[model samples]
Target: MAGEIPRAQPPPAEPDPVRDAHPYVLLWQWRRNPLRRRTDRLRAWIALGLALFVLLAAPAAMYAVGDTVHRHYRSTAEHEARTRDQRPAVLVHDAPRHPEPGSDEARETRYPVEVRFTGPDGAVRTGTTDVEPGLPADSTVLVWVDAAGEITGPPLTADEIRSRTMGWALLAFLGVVLAGLAAHGVAGLVLHRRNLAGWDAAWADTARRWTRAP
Candidate 1:
C-alpha cells in the first residue's frame, strides 16, 4: 500500500453559460489580457477612430454646408431685389383653375392669369402672370416686374433662404454620420472574419495534437 501510485483526478466540467458569463468591458481589446490578439487591438482602435470621425466630421460637414448655402442664397436674394420690384396690378380675366397637362399640382398651385399693370415708363401694360385660382376679373394683386417691365417671380424671402440652409445642413450632417457608420461596419466585418479564421486554425491544430495523443 505504501508503494502504490495515486489515481489521476478528472478535470471539472465547465458549463457554457458559466464560462461565457464574464463581465462586459468597455474596451476589452485595449486591455493587456493574454488572450487578446494583435487583430483584436487593431479592430478596437479602428472602431474608436471611426466613432471620433463620425462625431467630428458630421458637425463639420453641417457647418460647411450651412455657410455655403447661406452665402449663395443671400447673394441670389440681393441680385433679385436689385433686378425686380413689385407693382400694383388688376386681373383682366379669371385665373385658370385647372393645371396644365403633365404638371405637378403641388408646385403649379397658381395658374397664369392676364393682368393690367403700369409699366416702368408709366404706360398701362398687359401681361400673363401666375396668380391664385378663383380670382375674379378686376381683382387687385401685387405682381413682380423686371427692369424691362416684364412680369417675373418674386425674390427669395429670408424665410425661404433660412429654411433651405437648415435643410441642406441637416442632410449633410446625416450623410456624414451614415458614411462613417457604414465604414466602421465594413471594417468590423472584416476583422470578425479574420478572427474566426484564426480561431478555426487554432482549433484544427489542437485537434491534430489530440489525435496523436497516447
Candidate 2:
C-alpha cells in the first residue's frame, strides 16, 4: 500500500436540500477562508437575506394581496347584489342572429340591443343589453338593472372571484421574487466590481514597491 500512488479525491457534489437543510450551502462563503474577500462575505449575507425574503416576506406579501383581492371582489359582489335587481325586459328590436361576415366571432355571440324594463323603483327603463343571437323584436328577456335603473353587467360568480384572486396573488408573489433577485444581482455586481478594484490597487502598490527608483 505504501508503494501505490494515492488517487485524487472526487470533487464535492452539489447541495441537496432533501439530504439536509443545506445551511452550510448558503453560508459557505461566510466561512473563514484565506481566499475569501470581504465582498464574498457580503454576497453571502445578501444571499441569506434573499432566501429569507423568499421564504417569509414573499408568502406574507402573497397572503396580503390575495386577501385584499378576495375582500375587494366579495365586497363588490355583495354591493352589486344588494343594489342591483333583475327585471324582465322586452326587446325593442330584433337581436343580431348572425356574426358579421369575414369575422372571427361565433354564430351565437350575444349582441347589444335596445330593451325596455321596469327598474327596482318600478319606473320604466330603456337601455341597451347583450342578448342571444336571433331573437325577434318584442321578445321577453331578463336583464340586470342598477338602483338607478341603468343596465349593468352581471355580478362576479364565486368561482370567478376565487380564480381571479388566485391569478393576481400568484402574479404578486412572482413579482416579489423577481424584485428580490434583481436587487441581489445588482448588489452582487457592485460588490464584484469593488473587489476587482481592491485587487487592482493591491497589485499596483506591490508593483511600485518592487520597482522603486534607485
Best model number under TM-score? 2
Residue range 35-137, candidate 1, lDDT tens digits: 7778778877888898899999999999999999999999999999999989999999887655454457634587788999998888899998888777799
Note each model's CA RMSD in angstroms: 9.9, 9.7
Candidate 1 — which residues are off by over 4 angstroms?
1-24, 96-112, 116-133, 147-150, 212-214
Q: Give the TM-score of candidate 1.
A: 0.69
Displacement of the residue 169 alpha carbon in candidate 2, Å: 1.9
Instruction: Give the poorly placed runs of model 2, Cα more than 4 Å off.
Output: 1-32, 99-108, 210-214
Q: How high is each candidate's TM-score?
A: 0.69, 0.77
Q: How far is candidate 2 from the true structure (C-alpha RMSD, Å)?
A: 9.7
